[model samples]
Target chain A: MDNLVFERTKGLTKKEFSYCPGCTHGIIHRLVAEVLEELNVLDTAVGVASVGCSVINYEYFDCDMQQAAHGRAPAVATGIKRVNPENTVFTYQGDGDLAAIGTAEIIHAAHRNENISVMFVNNAIFGMTGGQMAPTTLPGQKTTTSQNGRDPYVVGMPIRMSEVLGQIPGAYYVERVSVHNPKHIIKAKKAIKKAFQNQIDGKGFSLVEFISTCPINWRMTPNDSLKWVEDSMIPYYPLGVVKDGDKND
Target chain B: MAKVLMKGNEAMALAAIKGGVDAFFGYPITPQNEIPEYLSRELPKLGKVFVQAESEVAAINMVYGAGGAGARVLTSSSSPGIALKQEGITYMAGSQIPGVIINVMRGGPGLGGIQPSQADYYQVTRGGGNGDYNCIVLAPENVQEAFDLVKESFDLADYYRNPVMIAADGLIGQMMAPVDIDKETPKLDLPEKDWATTGMKNRRTKENKDVDPNIIVSLSLVDTVLEEMNLVLQKKYTHMRENQQRYELINIEDAEIVIVAYGTSSRICRSAMEILKEEGIKVGMIRPITLWPFPEKAFAEIPESVKGLLTVEMSMGQMIDDVKISNNGKLPVGFYGRCGGVIPEPEEIVNAVKDFLGGLNG
Candidate 1:
């Protein structure tokens, strides 16, 4: 009857997303869900939701979930993966939750080469806290915290987590991808799939960093936010595979 | 099983194994390092998980994850490390996850010392973590009691779906004594942990056929929802208070003075009672085993002949507040303490009891 060309992924629950208008989090969530479903790991997947805009992601993923304290999702994921080795475990974290307060946790998780996946969303601002400056917030970008535009001398430069984690010997696969347009959206899904597949194949500590947009906090229209991500964010955080364990082997 | 001489930290480690711990996560801290060392060597042999986390903060969060995943998890640290873990501890409590934590106390306002101290009485009995939550704290007076309580803590944690703590002092962690590792602990009729996040593949309910994914979370953005959750937690705490009060009375019958103490201080009080008895003075003790529940019923058992109460501790009288509250001003209360890793002798406690009684008489 109907063409059946498109439908919702089974990895997602019936709960509707509550992201602000023009936020790319909904799109990223769809890509992750699609990848989990395509890989047939939805039922066995355990997602650790961190503090931030995505803290309530437990309601969106149709899989077992745990809500971790601020900046502790990596540690939580490590625990889940270590005990339930056969289960697929991953953490969903925003920049402030991963790069700032949880730096030690994420670094140590990588150092241990824990067999888990990580989905890091970088919108360059603390979306849930009403546009505070994030560790990933670009220098010269204005936010509630950096009213005079970011001064690298005053605070610090934006941290590129994918590149930082890629250098770690324990990290098996690391990549940075963006979701600004349809073409890049397809590429982002590919990287996300590989990250999950690496874990399915027993690879250690895979991570996919998504360059997402926060239109509400960016003080720009949804379309302008996408343009900003391409024009501003991409020049600083280039997209592509940062490391591949298979190639090293 | 036959008794074997075991160091306190090692004995507790073995007891945790015997208690059916599924995983151990911990960090290196003074006075409690032996615990993680023992588990790091032993757990792998038993095909159980053991992780030396980056810090006490990570270790406790790991405990939260494993416990949420339906594994019986344990972690251990000393005073300063335990302070670092308060955040994760509160999260576990709020999530109603089951975990066992061992706090082998050392002295501290900050980095106090490596020696024995009961200074953590307030931190353990009162909530060290945020929120309206209380961990079931067990204070053991000796190595054997420490072993037994540690083994039972897992069961208690699971039965209540709450965190449990073994509030041992440094003496309990470093001292050596004989312990029957196979000693039987009372079994609890625990409910099945169907809420654990073990996956959603086979989980099903008869009515729904397809079960919803189990979510382990403590975040309730709605104020009303959080208040309701707090009420539920309060009910659980009240039930714990009703059923879990434990204490031991020694020579309390027909005694003219009673002593309140727990852990290493209680052991000293026992020797003090014997010394007072030898001097023809009747002295007794109410040794509290459950610090949070605080054994108020034991106060009711105080002999009418008792003139006053003396609470002895290794710190500057942290447990005196509980003793006063339990005594309810029926008898005058006095405190005797030696702080900064100092241990009081039996003769000192004997003198303190006499002085307390003299004040009451005057």
Candidate 2:
């Protein structure tokens, strides 16, 4: 008899994903669910869903979930973590939700050294609002809002959030990874696990940023989107550990 | 419990603790800074959470998250800070997460001034935030009532699964009065927060085997679905209007003129009533404790002897709108106000009443 090697993680619900075809959000969700299941924290974990495509993430994650206002997930997660310190708390946010209107919230949350994990998904395009320009959108990347492609002089350069957050003294661990291929997917999962582990260990603040894909928003095929992330996206948003407080210790 | 001298803000903080608040999140704004300061000192001792958030926006969102997670939460601010919190407050209302917010209102229309003002009356009662939602507004006239209302506000919030506002002013926040600090606050019987996002573990295994995972969300994109949800909220509001009307009538049975006011302005109006009574001008007063319910019943029972109505406020006549609406134009209602941190003196209110009485005769 052939032994079963793998199964769906219990951290996910029976509900089907609402993400578009070839969207990397599904892979990111699977990785997070698998991490929570392996860590045995799904039952006690609480997730704050952001306002972008994953606004209905509460339906997908088999944990207590709250849908917060646009770009306010960090502040909401701070409240949850502070109120329920014993429970594992995290926020899942997109590029537009995190790097743009929520800059103050994310910066202050890191400054406060809040005991919560943040999963920052940078897709370089606003997927939910139908391909609008995101704060992390690369220069020359065409978006619905930036129809003529992003202008470096008009909008300034793309925000490197991991590097910006790594400078905060309160941030105990910060890493940026990608999920374009199997090898990179494995690496991204490891970084996500470490981020949650730091929070479980009573560390101050931990953030794991995934360079994700939005094929429909990017106006490309799923395979081309993956290749584009590896080529155009990686060159601009260099991946690797930006700050590892535990490693220093 | 014996009555003890306490500032209104301090009394509110103690009441929050006695009321079993699990978390207090706020940022320092003048006329209400004492609230956060007191909570920071006291909540930690009681094993409750207290955080001075970076901004009023973050503070209200924190309250939103804590309340969503089934924790009793509190956040306090003044006019400018309160303006920053309207976005989160609207979200909480949309999500039906219960929480308590204290607005010790200061001057406004920009960062007007940090002195007492009722300019926030329209903002609080008429829905400061966007969308078709109204938070229950509790206006307290003294330190004792402020303390009592803080505790009651939490109960009302959880009972209705909605946010409640303690709309005191700078005078109430800054002044001191005798109150029963150690009074036994009756633990109100409240419904279990089954709708709260309190983990999916046991809920997943409960009686409803086919129920989806518990989620606290406010985003309803579908038009018909949102309309249905709005109708449900409208029904709740209608119920509150019918059952939650509260007001105090003083000597209205034998008066020729009625003065309408709430919070600090009501106290001032009372002093003015005493002054007018000494002058033999028949003056009665209606102090509304619940602002949103608007105490329309009190207006309905206005004595036949009453010739006119006058509204007293610290701002330039915001609550006057509700007073007019409740009065239904049955009596000529006049307005009296002082803005930009100026408190209306008793003599000014008496003169305004005199003017209204003259207009009645004219």
Candidate 3:
């Protein structure tokens, strides 16, 4: 962790972090910054942020992050990435932002095979908006709005964005991982690194959906939240490469 | 008050350039196509950035990118075309990015027709995009306001750091008018942006670091944090509701009826009101220049003095609802209009106004 300390982020003083201690977005953000530091892509990289909790990600990542509305990170990322093709572009989006409001945008970007890597965080609830049922919300998970758990009969089943996006052309790589455990955290980091490398290599629309935890929103301790992700979120959203280049369904 | 001949769309583009905008990202749409044509030639010549984006999505996203970078930027499109831009618009609101978007509205409900129509009234004024965010929608009555608002919009956007929309109909884009901005374009060399990703290595980073750096962003997925963000926006919007209304009131005092109207319809309604004034019909008009801030209090006040009300628009009955809500049931309010390029004559409006008066008088 000492070697991984990003000098570019040295100026950032940790004001009491608002995020729950083990909530994975911090971990993912750390990993993204660490990789960028190692690759010296910090200055050349432009990040697009979607709606939801990640909106403030601009404050954390020591990169030129542009704020995009809802699911529009993909489209904005496309704009910066395509215009400055030499610059590496990525988007940090959450389930509701990517899977719900930005569904069409990310799907189209994947279809166009826009040279952008999407760092998708799936906490299975609209954690930023009082825990409403998200597009990736498990079928029976109780959220603030989905008081009776998400009723598939009323709200429909949670969407599998990785699988759905894998069908598009130019979607070079699509993987799903969890950040609920140290082992899972390492796997998530590797997947994120590969996605960034894919963009660096000019491969298009790579994504890594990190199954993260939302302890405060879930009304659980950070530890229990990680366990909830391991116990409940994974069964519905199994972590694995949904589609790699030339890989099967 | 003076008359000058200019194409509506071209005037709108000139207005943006005159406003000292830093960039124009656009794709072509009919009736409004002249804007892109003018920007393609003029924006770069003015030393502003102009990008003909790959699609409407890309065009709007380009605005998002530039706005995110804290540059004064904008994009333009028609109804069917603008629907494609909703996602980007929604994101702009959520991100609290300041920018301008122009909608030269055409027929819809599904690309229903391309001819001039007011069908997009509800779409533009009542949150055409998804989500709960309300964009400040400005409805221009003629080519002049269309141009003037483009300049005014940039200021409003920067002042509030929220997206400001100058929503006009196809008629406004197709029609010609004389416009004069007393203010000259500022002589200052373009001010540098603190957030724009201009690829210039000399710029200071957002964190005030001497070395170049990229910005980091993540929209909140944490409930408490998102709640705080939304509350901050709510306060901004409340301020807008109090201070953002721009409207005109004509002969509202001592009138039996007030016609609530905006955009092109308001212009036509003004003419109709003049004719009715000659005929001794006691009618007044409320022209809402800023439709989103919606001169509601002004409209509601009129109901106390006027006996009846009527709404003039190009849509089936979009602004009518707003008029009714503003009336607060203190008096009866009715609607009149044509859609999809069939302009309703003064006679039709006269008849509707007379009937509403008649119903109240009976």
Candidate 4:
């Protein structure tokens, strides 16, 4: 008889993901689901799905969910956590949703030290709206709107959200990680789990930024995209814990 | 429970607490600051949630979250702030969540003034947010009515599973009057919020099987699916129109000219009606308590002796469109108004009514 070793986490429903091929949102979603399940909070987790490709994540997350307006996920999560302090609350937001239109909301949510976790997926492009330039878009990166490559002088350099959010005193934990390789994936999952655990321990705001890949938007094969993230993206958005309230304490 | 003098903003705040509000999230704006102030101090003591959000947009979205999570929530703002809230309002309406919003009217085309004006009449009644939707809009004339309607608005919101708005002018927000906070109003038989996103832990179906997790969302990407949702919303609006039309008719039995007004304008019109009665000019008034239902049914009660209608408003001729539509061209309709934070006096409405009658006879 074969020994059963691994199975799908019940934290996620059986619904097929709508993400494009080679996109890491599926991996990230699974990691979050597995984390919630391992923590035994899947039954009480309330996820806020923000605008972008993850806008329909409510269909996949096997937990009570709320889909918020563009860039309003943090506000929505704040509301949920305030009313149900015992329940786990988190927001899944893409770069455009978190770094651009929803800047004020995310900043204030962290400033208030809201006891919630955030999964910020930064792929350097707007995937849902068809590969538009994003606030996290790298300089010299070519996007639909940046036909001639991004000009840092005109559009400004990419924002380092982990750096900005890590500086917030209320933010209990902040980390930047990737899923381009198995080793990084393991590290990424560990960070994501700790973010949720921080909320469980009633620490404060926690966010984990994933250097995810969008092969379709990047105009590359899945393998090529992973290679690019390893070589180019990691150098710019280096992986590591930016802040840890536990370490500070 | 005895009547106590209170500012309009404070009275509404107290009434929300009595209405069983579980949370309030709001931003500070002129003429409505007292509301958030009172709640921020009192909600914490009561173990209720109160948040002073970073902006009006965030506050309204917080209202959406709390409402979706099976809590009675409220948010308050003035004119420009309400404009900022329209985005979240549309989302809440589409998601079919229950929440209360209070808009203390201020002058505006673009931050026109901070003083009282009924300029948001069109925005409030016409579904300020995008989409084919309507929010039940209640216009209260005084502090007592403001309290009563706000308290009742929570029930209306939950009963309809939609947002309800209390539209009051800045005069009402700043003024003080006696209010019986504990006054009884009929409670609605609201349905259970099984759809709320409390969790999926112990929820079970009739067959004793586990239920699926609840999702509060408004996105229907397909055209056909969206159309079906629109039809359902239309049906709800129809029911509201049939059952929720509310108005107060004064001296309409034998009047030659009837006036249409609401909120603070209605108070001025009532005074004008008294002045016109003393002059023997025979004027009547129709005060719309619910603005979205538009009180068109009240027009049918306009006596045949009424030869014309005059709409008096704090804004420049905004509500006159509704007045004309309700009148249906059976009688001539005229308009009188002020704007840019100006309040029309009773004398102006009296003159407008006399002119309307003269124009009809001419």
Clashes of each: 0, 0, 27, 0
Scored by Cα lDDT, where does model 3 land?
A: 0.78
lDDT of 2 by residue, A6-108 (tens): 8889989989999998898999999999999999888778899998998898889988889999989999999888887877889999999999989989999
Which predicted model would earn the best lDDT? 4
TM-score of model number 3:
0.69
In the range B1-362, model 1's lDDT, one tens digit per residue, is: 88999899999999999999999999998999899999999999999999999998999999999999999999999988888999998999999999999999999879999999988887877767888899999999999999999999999999999999999999999999999988999889989899999888757657666878999998899999999988888999999999999999999899998888899998988888888898999988899999987889899999799988888989998889989988998998889999989889988998898888888888
Which 10 successive residues of model 3 chain A have the least lDDT summed?
Answer: A8-17
Cα error of candidate 4 at position B338, Å: 0.8
Off by over 4 Å in 3: A1-35, A38-44, A49-60, A67-74, A78-88, A91-249, B1-4, B181-218, B300-305
Q: Which 10 consecutive residues of model 4 chain B have the lowest summed lDDT?
A: B201-210
DockQ of each: 0.88, 0.75, 0.21, 0.89
| Top candidate (DockQ) | 4
CA error at residue A216 for candidate 1, angstroms: 1.5
lDDT of 1 by residue, A31-123 (tens): 999999999998899999999999999999999999999999999998888899988999999999999999999999998999898999999
Query: Cα lDDT for residue B55, model 4?
Result: 99
Winner on lDDT (2 vs 3): 2
Model 1 residue A97 lDDT score: 98
Better of 2 and 3 by DockQ: 2
Score each candidate by Cα lDDT: 0.92, 0.90, 0.78, 0.93
Q: Please provide, for model 2 over B1-362, each residue's C-alpha lDDT reduced to its tens digit, 9 standing for 90 to 100.
A: 78989999999998998788999999998999899899999899888899988889999999999999889999999999989999999999888989999999999889889899999988898776888898889999999999998987888889878899999999999899999977764455788887776665646665665544567787788999998888877887887899888899988988999999899888988889999999999999999999987889999889899998898888889888988888888998998899999998899999999999998999
